[model samples]
Target chain A: MSGTPNQGPGLRYPSNKKSIYDRNLNRTKNAELSRAAFAYLFIEMIAYAQRGVSNVGDLEQKLNTQGYPIGLRLLDLLLSRSSNPLASIRPTRILPLLQFIAQTLYRHLFGRPADALEKSSTEPGQYMLFDNEPMVSQYVSLPRELSSLNCAAFVAGVIEGVCDGAGFPTEGVTAHSVGEQEQGKDAKAMWPDKTVFLIKFKPEVLEREEILGRGGG
Target chain B: MVVFALMIISKSGGLIYNREFHTGLSKLTSNDYLILAGSFHGMHAITSQLSPAPRIPYITPQNNMLAPSPFPNRPTGIEVMESSHFRLQCFQTQTGTKFLLVTEPQQPNVDTMMKKVYELYADYVMKNPFYTVEMPIRCEKFDRGLDGFIKVRG
Candidate 1:
């Protein structure tokens, strides 16, 4: 149905009479927002998430929740954009999906692929995605009271969303600053902002992967 | 190319967001917007089901081989509706979120506009930590981004 002649209450038109629906999505595809603007927005996000939080863990969890939906949304958006429509395909296995995240997703968001992707030597379903200098936390300097907090948990949430959205469900994804935990001082100094995203898929996902691997081969 | 309005419906047929840009159409109350979205979702489902089944390609004895189809699964819903005054274009994401754009009947590149709206939704609404899934969007950044893009470019 069309609208009445009178303007609806609460309907605020832009000064130029244009709305968001009129914008083109591809206009910003190659354009980059200013780093300062991004930093300011990120700082505001962290501040908003930090309010009324008693513990660093809770604060990080809030940030993670914030990033989770983003990851989910990005999964579909990136998948559609990366492949040609005629031969479009999505990652069904673990390795290819992880590669998609470490490469395509990373490059899309950060302008660089992740530093490394490593499976845990001891854990069955755990994989580590490393970013040498997480852009999200590049300017974040935690005070002593919240020294344990890592803002990159937001990014970790994104990884978890990608994994979960791709149908490879994960138990949880967490971000940890590994720079301070490095064994050698030289290593620590080299990448002080190194953050590792630990992705642990659910047991059922791994079990399905094993079954598919055996049968498909 | 005037855009009359935009409506975002969640996967389950709930109206999550609705905004009007131009005054070309009759004004509907908020409740009316919900009804319009729900009815449209239902109509879309019916229309999709009404689509004819894929034809069975006959294989001649001399040409028995059928190469796999290159195209992905086709969208099975009503994508565009046109009236004398306005046109409605729907863009449905893989996750089933629907972006509906009401534009002038002769408007060009409505699909592109829908995609851009979807992107804005992804960035400003979905990425905002405070926004709950399937909820009404009240993100300020999305509004500003939408205004800036549409006012200047649309």
Candidate 2:
């Protein structure tokens, strides 16, 4: 520190500094990122989370926690990029919010929309977003003992984060690989990385959705 | 392009990484490496400030209204040092972390190789939440990446 001037870190900042908060998210709607870079980063992220964890489930949870904050941050970034950036126009109902995640958010991050969206007939307030081959989990292959592990847990965490940030708290979001089952039944052999993200919203979110619906009447 | 070794010095002059990609160079004690990193960091800081300012006084109070300057960012520090045995190249990132590459003397384009190393460090080490800043980087992924990168270069 002797040769350097005694100035705060702020002085090092560029004079024409631009804040990420001030940037328009929608401007890069067509931008693309290198898949190799993304895959390598995701691989390292998994390896980092795998350290010191006792079981596969703990690894999944760690990945979830890591993805949670990203989800929360992306919630604002994605919503603000919409044609209607106003918070008042944000999706208040479950169906629209699910569509936003499945279509809008998925398209932005993965370059393509999620494969499908379905609601559970037996369980109310439960929705599922399906990805025939979730981009993040494309190269991940679990051993037989850890076959239960799904790398898509990180994506589920992001979804959960987005939901929680948008005033729709959820019971939990989980990822289940349906490749084996779907390959046999649905004959979707190409998508061996098929994953389903089950999002179970809290009871209060449903009640709020109903109340919001009534108020709009 | 006979590269010898790579060393990463933390922002405050600590030795976070020292790896030898090619053999035949004399090795020093770990403590000596630390001292070398500290002194280099100090020298870098001194040299950065000592850079000759351009004669044109394009910067002004109302700089925002002006067109973007064609000049690149300010020179950070001593980029290259030549010796009979080896040539040392330094690349300092905007955040103050420095990467030093030791290659065979007269090796061309060390700058590009150093830039690639910096990219790996940013992705594998800095992005990992487990990596505490200014501490010795023990990330396995970083090591693997650095190894792979050097291998590809050769």
Fraction of true contacts kept, per model? 0.00, 0.00
TM-score against native, each model = 0.52, 0.53
- For candidate 1, the clash count comes to 8
lDDT per residue, candidate 2, B45-147, as tens digits? 8998899854655677798688886655676779889999889999887777889999999788787888888888877676654456788877655777788
**Off by more than 4 A, model 2:** A1-25, A85-88, A182-188, B1-154
The model with the greatest lDDT is: 1
Q: Write the per-residue lDDT of candidate 1 for residues B1-154, one digit (tens) a residue.
A: 6888889999899999888887656779999999999999999888877887666666686556666466535446899999998899998887778889988899988877878888778766765545567887776557766887788756
- Please give me the DockQ of candidate 1 compared with the native complex: 0.01
Flag regions of model 1 displaced more than 4 Å.
A1-29, A83-87, A179-183, B1-154
| Candidate 1 chain B, run of 10 with poorest lDDT | B66-75
Please, what are the lDDT tens digits per residue for candidate 2 over residues A89-194? 6677888888889887898888788999999899999998899888776545454567788888999999999899888999889998886654685455556668
Error of 1 at A44 (Å): 1.0
Docking class of 2: incorrect
